[model samples]
Target: MRRLGDLEAEIMDRLWTWDRPATVREIVDDLNRTRPLAYTTVMTVADILHRKGMLRREKSGRAWSYRPACTREAYSAALMRDVLGESPNPGGALAHLVEQLTPEELAALRSALDSVDRGAPGDGPR
Candidate 1:
């Protein structure tokens, strides 16, 4: 997976948050805090997402209702995979991934891993 643009990621965020399929108008409404998006602009972005396999759409009267193609975690994992694939050493790649985390994030990761070793699920997936 390639890096998503800001608008694309925002749309995906909206999709993932929705419990039901949303029309372009609904997505635009959610995003309106940033700017006033025209209906056609929202529709265009949604359509692009569908073509990229990042959105699922169903007929909703005249327009389509769109939802996430996958959960947010899955999409993030895909992006991580794409980025990590370019690294020369898997171990070094993992180290680099760890290095970017804030202290709190690193601690959370350690705590989660400890729980995993104790035969438990903790902190949930990213």
Candidate 2:
């Protein structure tokens, strides 16, 4: 998967935080509260995200209302997988990542691994 640009990441953040489909105007207005941005620019980026299959859009009046094609967790997992794929030793990379996790996070990771070992539905191949 491709990495998001700063603006695109910002836009996605808004959509994900809002947890609903949003129009370009809504995104621009929200972003403008922190820094100025053009409506056309948000619209263009939204279009690009849609084409990249990262976003799904529907016609809302004359404008498109956009939402993430996948949940934020899914996106993050994909990014982690991408990074691991780039490593010469994915196992070592994963070990390094696990070492950096807090106790609570380590517990969660262990639980997730347990679920995978138990043949959880969404767990990919063994």
Candidate 3:
């Protein structure tokens, strides 16, 4: 998956955190609580995200309501997949990643792998 820009990320963050469809105005209002941003800018970026297949939008009265097309976890997994796919030493890279994990995280990874092998869902990473 393609990485998001600052504005694209900021917009997606709000939509994912809210876990619901929201208008560009709603996102702009929430973002404005901390920083000054133009509504048109957000609207344009939201449209861009929609075009990128990162967001799904529908007409809501006079405005468009947007939501993330994939879950945050799904996005992270895609990034990880992209990294591993591009690496010349994928196994070595994965081993290095595993070496950096905490004991708890390692256990979670083991459990998730085992669950997958068993065709069941495990408690996700911590």
Candidate 4:
């Protein structure tokens, strides 16, 4: 996984929330909640996600329907690991990251790590 731009993240968010693949018109309508965007822009974002390996697209009734290749949480955690895993000492990098977090965030992160250590993400993100 790699760091995604704002548009790519938003498109991925939509796909994660979706129960099924969505067409260009569906994405355009959903994006309308934030701001007006062109159909082409939405379509382009889907294309970018496909290139990034975040999404799978298929032709359906003269339109392209797109779905996420993995859950957003899985993708996010994979990306986090990819970015942090590159450091010579991931433990040190993780410690530094924890040092920068707010107390409330630290508690949340503690719980999340505890959950992962127990077995799997269980009720949270992978």
By lDDT, the best candidate is: 3
lDDT (10s digit) by residue, model 1, range 57-107: 999999899988788888689777756554535555444443356789988
> Rank order by TM-score, top first?
3, 2, 4, 1
Candidate 3, which segments miss by more than 4 Å at Cα?
A: 1-4, 85-126
Candidate 2 lowest-lDDT run of ten: 91-100
Q: For model 3, how does the per-residue alpha-carbon lDDT over 1-126 read when each residue is reduced to its tens digit? A: 232378898888889999999999899999899989989888888989999999998999999999999999998998767655545355564443433467899888777677664644644444
Q: How big is the positional error of residue 48 in model 3, measured in Å on the Cα after superposition?
A: 0.8
Model 2 residue 20 lDDT score: 95
- Return the lDDT, model 4, position 25: 90
Clashes of 3: 0
lDDT string, candidate 2, 37-123, tens digits: 878888888899899998999999998999999999997898766655545445554443433457898778767787664655766
Native-referenced Cα lDDT, model 4: 0.76
In candidate 1, stretches whose alpha carbon ends up further than 4 angstroms from where it belongs are 1-4, 81-126
Q: How high a TM-score does candidate 4 get?
A: 0.61
- How many collisions between residues are there in candidate 2? 0
lDDT of 4 by residue, 70-90 (tens): 887886798676655655355
Q: Rate the local accuracy (lDDT) of all candidates.
A: 0.76, 0.81, 0.82, 0.76
TM-score for each model: 0.60, 0.63, 0.64, 0.61
Q: Point out the higher-scoring one by TM-score: 1 or 3.
A: 3
